[model samples]
Target chain A: MGKPKKLLNNPVDVVTELIDGLTAACGGDLRRLDGRNAVVRTEIADGKVALLIGGGSGHEPMFPGFVGPNLADGAPCGEVFAAPTPDLILDTLSAVDRGRGVLMVYGNYAGDNMNFDIAAELAEEVGIVTRTVRVWDDVAAAPLDRITDRRGIAGDFFVIKVAGGAAAELSDLDEVYRVAVKARDNTRSMGVALAAGSIPETGERTFELPEDEIEIGMGAHGEPGIARRKITDADAIAEEMTDRILADLPFSAGDEVALLVNNLGATTCMEMLIVARKVHHVLKARGIAVHRTDVGSFLTCQEMAGLSITLMKLDGELKRYLDMPARSFAYSRA
Target chain B: MGKPKKLLNNPVDVVTELIDGLTAACGGDLRRLDGRNAVVRTEIADGKVALLIGGGSGHEPMFPGFVGPNLADGAPCGEVFAAPTPDLILDTLSAVDRGRGVLMVYGNYAGDNMNFDIAAELAEEVGIVTRTVRVWDDVAAAPLDRITDRRGIAGDFFVIKVAGGAAAELSDLDEVYRVAVKARDNTRSMGVALAAGSIPETGERTFELPEDEIEIGMGAHGEPGIARRKITDADAIAEEMTDRILADLPFSAGDEVALLVNNLGATTCMEMLIVARKVHHVLKARGIAVHRTDVGSFLTCQEMAGLSITLMKLDGELKRYLDMPARSFAYSRA
Candidate 1:
């Protein structure tokens, strides 16, 4: 296994160093919890349900950059490719929680489930209300009948955005959870990895891949996907991903959607724009309307070169929420 | 030389297809002039001096995606790693002119100079007033006496932003050009490249880089730089780049500025944030206050793995322009 050369100091300290760097660049919009691997919004708005989201770090803009107003109130960061512990989650929860209770959101993963579940129990013991919403939108992870068996991937962004927007619009915990469910249920995603993302700590690769080949449907963490094959045209890859996502959720003709051409890690924006061209053709041919499109590195593995295509079936409510004004170090809308 | 595998179709037509993809995904905010390799704002602001920027096309989000309100009025795209022809620039200038005149901006490349200079003469022949601003802020490219000999890299973003903001705020072409020149003069940048970005057309590497080594002060186009050595710690690399850039522009203590930690191409956001942390520390230790910091891929070279640090000294006017609200397919602020 070849480890991609990295510019890091003390591989074991990569995550801590990453957060320290992130908070400093953000000025005062973000802050770290004392002695904990977590971060919270510096100015928590009153009378709103706190939306908490987390997972393994490495997906830069996703887990931490998503912490701001109209987004996740706080995020408990885990080590690269590892989930946070219950205690870490509790720290962020306590710091961000106001009188409005809390809603926890994350992708479907074993470590994440166990840690978050334990933290929810801990929160209950402390008498703070908590609700959970797990994302299972990666159709390639499981059959339609076993949807919950699917692992969460980049589709978490759409769900989180809706959840954040809902939280900002209302104070009721159940209402926020309901819209979050709606967003998660309507979303679907699939990806193809042309290269593996390496972890700096172990100087190890997450998976092995042959040059001139690609793995279709690879997860964000480099987990097993549907198939691997010789490298082919980008249009074919985009078609494969779009067809799978559209069919699983049955996002058919006349349906409106917010399209996401997310770079898994190191795919260039130029390549992504090409992929978006094909995706647009695919959706247009089916009479679907693309309400909006986001093309950039939203979620990522560490320097993995590939991308994911996500479609969020949008309604009047979801569209309004998606268009709401939001700003962060990673993403913003004017 | 290793050709990093890419996801593109009909490599020769990549640029045209990229323009097609970008305009399509943008959902009507941007459009291409019929029968030309140029992109323009869907609705140009009337009576405003047109801001035109162009360069090679491989630097995604720079030449085309930057075309929108409060930014470049239009951008003529050249082939990958090549400059656009004067005819292409003429086509854009002809279409975007609104009586106020045109101001063209681009990196300090020889080919770009000839083409843009020719276009300026042609614009005069057609009775449309025109001015030009060439960016030369790469510290490693030249010594102080030969500052204009430096190649422009990610610093183009800051110059274009200030130019666009000025164009939107004032009706005078010379004033817009003056602010752009000031912005260009105040900015300084330096970068390090770990890997080379390959061209899809020939599947050939731009330059060779040994494993376990990096080239400090590398230009975005893989141009030769100051030194190449074994990979070192992030802090040391940041210090080398910061010291060179700060000294070149004399960004002394108590100076305020906007700092840009730009990814060259395939460098992940995780690596960039780590670099940002070190950069922030270096500036703080020198008593320099970072007014703002942007960490992401604002400009890139295919899939090159490395990054550049850009600092633009901000005066009251420059800061005002820097803070102006602008949104494009690739960048935005809420």
Candidate 2:
């Protein structure tokens, strides 16, 4: 509620301390390039298109936890929701890049795009091939036609899964890029916030909303959204969110889709499943098939009280990759 | 706040729907015993000491998600916090039990223990060998001198992990029982609740508290905790919970331990890390070495606003088993 006194060195040191702690906790599974805020797992093998992703520190298991086998090769973590420097990205690419080039995948934020573009240029100059796929799955982030204007949310799960699986199979950079692009294009996400989040070092609320209301189109970093309205039942809220996402995606009857019911932050599995049930009904009413579903806090926004639904149209290739066996602390495929 | 709508067909139907959903989502990695609620993974090879573990339902990833290739042979899901019937447990044992016999491990709750005991008797009557190790980790649930009298919380993660690893390695039933007992003995846990959880069918809060206050030591079923206090700095609250856990366990200076900072329901990774940092600092100050650490929402209390910390005294065998590779939707060794 006031200046939150964190048990740390200082406000500026919070991010670095957290990163150091993460590095220590990961055992030998992860390695951070010297003098930079980027990290990569040791599992990256030879001659594969390295996938690099990151942006923000709090929504962990998202950018970093998703950096092991069949996922990304490296992640450049920034301050909470802040963009990492181009040098950090370059350093990360240098650490994991083999002869197989690299792909830079991240959210659709101007700061991230600007910095990653610079990193890509620098990487190219150094004789490493590079491509970028901007994730924009938030239907509420922008209008449907201008989907590129939307923000990336939980849909990053699908992006990481497809990109990682493609990389695992040693697909060429072009094919991996195409797969990543297709996954991104098929994903549609929207979120609702029930409460606010507080940045530990600053002890500041990322955004504000009335106690009795919720922001339906809330962004990950507490950005303002479509509108705030009275809180309704979980089913009603899930219905509203799913309807918006389904309409934006325009799935036909009997179309098979993979559902990702993700927690923006601290939403419970109980609540997530409630939303999942409603989503099941919503998709069923439209005759769209749900081939797979992931219900948990995969992509979170610090401790914000909210959730986002990401549905991707599942094709054979996508389903195959999504079903591929992989393991991480936050997610796994059978 | 009011009577929740009948999103479900009926209370008895919830478990079946969830079971069907679980099997469908498992991508053929999991299956339920015909006409029974018992679940087993397809990769469970014969001749192992069939490590079977389970408890109440609602702890989705806990009792079922943990059953897989390198884990338990089967899990019997109950209703809410209620224990599954002895017949249900017998069904699971008969489905997965090999000539190597079976070892049952579960929380120390009265209902669970009673049913498991009854199931053991039935197994013996049929000339089948069975044993069980009860997990008691919640320090607030009992006195320090009677640690085994405490309730089990998220500490099940460490216990199941070690037990599963031994079982996969074809450890004898006695060895499996020993490992389970060691984990349950060394493990200590404590919880703090920021809010209450709602029962899905009735849409009612299992417990209630003032807006500005939280209940410490609350159980998964929304029971009253040790005390209620106003929320404050995250570090202070983390220290409060950690202090109680450490004191109850009485870990000496230079004692090596593995820590599990668990999210009860909706706590975010950022907050979980904040709690972990504080706990780490506290232990580090005492010269205690945290050989391994895991922080996440492994065991949840629906959408309850809280978290629990589980500390296990580490040794060579415990560390090896804890470090063993695992693949589940909610956890992984790597």
Candidate 3:
């Protein structure tokens, strides 16, 4: 295979250089705390709860882009698709703690869970308040009994949006964490990947699947998919992905939802909208009301050649918070 | 060549369907005029100057996205990569014609210019005041004396922003047109293409070059690039593109500029930012003061592997307006 063209001082220098560039782009609203691999917001409201979220580095604007006035205050940048160290997590907690407490939100993954668990233990020794809310929205990542054990995907949009709104309102750590968990519980997502991705450092394919085929339930990390099938029409692919997610989540007639049609990096906007229309058709046929809809690349997987459908079953409170104004590098609502 | 995926229903079906979707998405602020292809903001300020803009449809969040509170009052949607008809332009002018008159802003394309000129003539005959400003920002599209002869690329971003800010303050048509013209005069852009794009409808490639080569000074419509050379690092690409654009414009050492690093399409955020770093280095080496910077996938060529750099020579007033709060589908500042 031909090598991917990239520009860097050294193979190992990609992540650190990108982090510094991100800080500059954010115009001081974000900062990397010295002596640690953690990023913190410049403005921290005293007496108001704080939120710190993060994941692997390649998912730009995900955990990092979600940081701002009404969103996350810190995001510990991890290795490419790898979790951050426990010390880094503790450093982020220390930086964001305003005596009101902090909530740690991220996708459910083995490495992240263990590291964050250790960080929480460390915070407890200092009497710093800490809470963790695991987002498990990828219906294809696990079966029903293991739903709580599934990995997260673009549904983290809803999770961060709700959690940020709660944190901005001076809600305590427990309250913020509760709402975030509820948001994650009410959301379901499934993705299909049409192409494989290459890691910048190693120049190696993250995962291997035959060309001219697709994985219906590919995770962000190039994880093994749930099913394999021939590449097909856009509508067919949409139907398959949406069908499985709706069936898994059990949205009833008259149910209301907020749909997020997410692009996994390389998928075009034209493709994302096709996914959105299919989602609309599916929900409308079930007499489900789509309270609000965002059709864009809110979360991404670095040009993964696919899209994901995230449906957050909405309640009155969730809808209100969902409608709240937000601004980020990749998305904004005023 | 393999068959290209059908990203939308059909090429002919896309513009109308997208407009319909946008109407639903705009939530009461937008309405399509009766019996015409025009969209006007319902809350258009009475007795305030009206601003109108339009072009090909593929660049969503462009002409249409800029229509709102502090921007153009209306925009006419056209076929993908094709200009709207004279009738559409005339209808848009008529719908937005308040007592204060209207200004027409569009990229400098042959079909768009002729059609808009005809619309202006027709509107003038009907006793409605109208002024037109053609944006010509692509330095590589044509020579300096024939700048107006070149096509507009991403530099239209600065044009719309300044014009919109002027119109929002209820500036007269003449002032809005003047500021818009000034913005166009001061802006210059040049692009580089790594891969060719398809029209979606035809399922045919727009242009083709060898895999190991790149086309510098590329146009947005996949027109022939100024130079085709062997692909190299991002730094080398930036050097050639920046040198050509800066030489054509000839800026002074201490000049202040607002830079826009736009992804044509398909270029990942990581790649785009890499280009951005080089752009900054080039401008700084010339002792220029960079006022504000915007780097994102603003203008696109439907997954084409390319990027464009737009340098807007700015004064204090222009800088303030450019930095003012802007809320659009794809761009936002608060």
> Which scores higher on TM-score, 2 or 3?
3
Report the Cα RMSD per candidate: 1.0, 4.2, 2.7
TM-score of each: 0.99, 0.84, 0.92
| lDDT tens per residue, model 3, B1-334 | 2434443565666666556545544546677677444567887767888889898877665667667766778888778788988888988888887778888888999989989999989998998898888888888888999887888899988988888888777457788787878888899999988876677677676888686888888888897768898888777888778788788877779998888888776666666666666777788898887776777776677767688999999987677667777655455667
Query: Which pairs of residues clash in candidate 2, taking residues 3 or more apart in a chain or in different chains?
Result: A254-A287, A264-A301, A266-B266
Q: What CA RMSD would candidate 2 show?
A: 4.2
For candidate 1, lDDT tens digit of each residue in B1-334?
5566788888988888888889988889889889577898889878999999998889998878888879888999999888999999998998889999999999999999999999999999999999999999899999989988999988999999999999999999999999999999999999899988887798788898888899998888889999999999998999988988888879899999899999888887878989999999999999999999999888888888899999999999999888899988877866
- Interface CA RMSD of each prediction in angstroms: 1.0, 4.8, 3.0
Off by over 4 Å in 1: none
Candidate 1, position B195, lDDT: 87
* DockQ scores of the candidates: 0.81, 0.27, 0.36
Error of 2 at A77 (Å): 2.5
Q: Each model's C-alpha lDDT? A: 0.89, 0.78, 0.77
Best by TM-score: 1
Which candidate ranks first by DockQ, i.e. highest? 1
Q: Distance (Å) between predicted and true CA of B223, model 1?
A: 0.7
Tens digit of per-residue lDDT, candidate 2, span A1-334: 3322223345565566555555555657677667466778777777878999888777766787777777788899888778888988888988888788898889999999999999999999999899899999999988887888889888998998988888788659989899899999999999888876678656687877765778888988887888788776666787888888888878788789999878777565545555676788788888988887787777777667788888999899888888777755455454
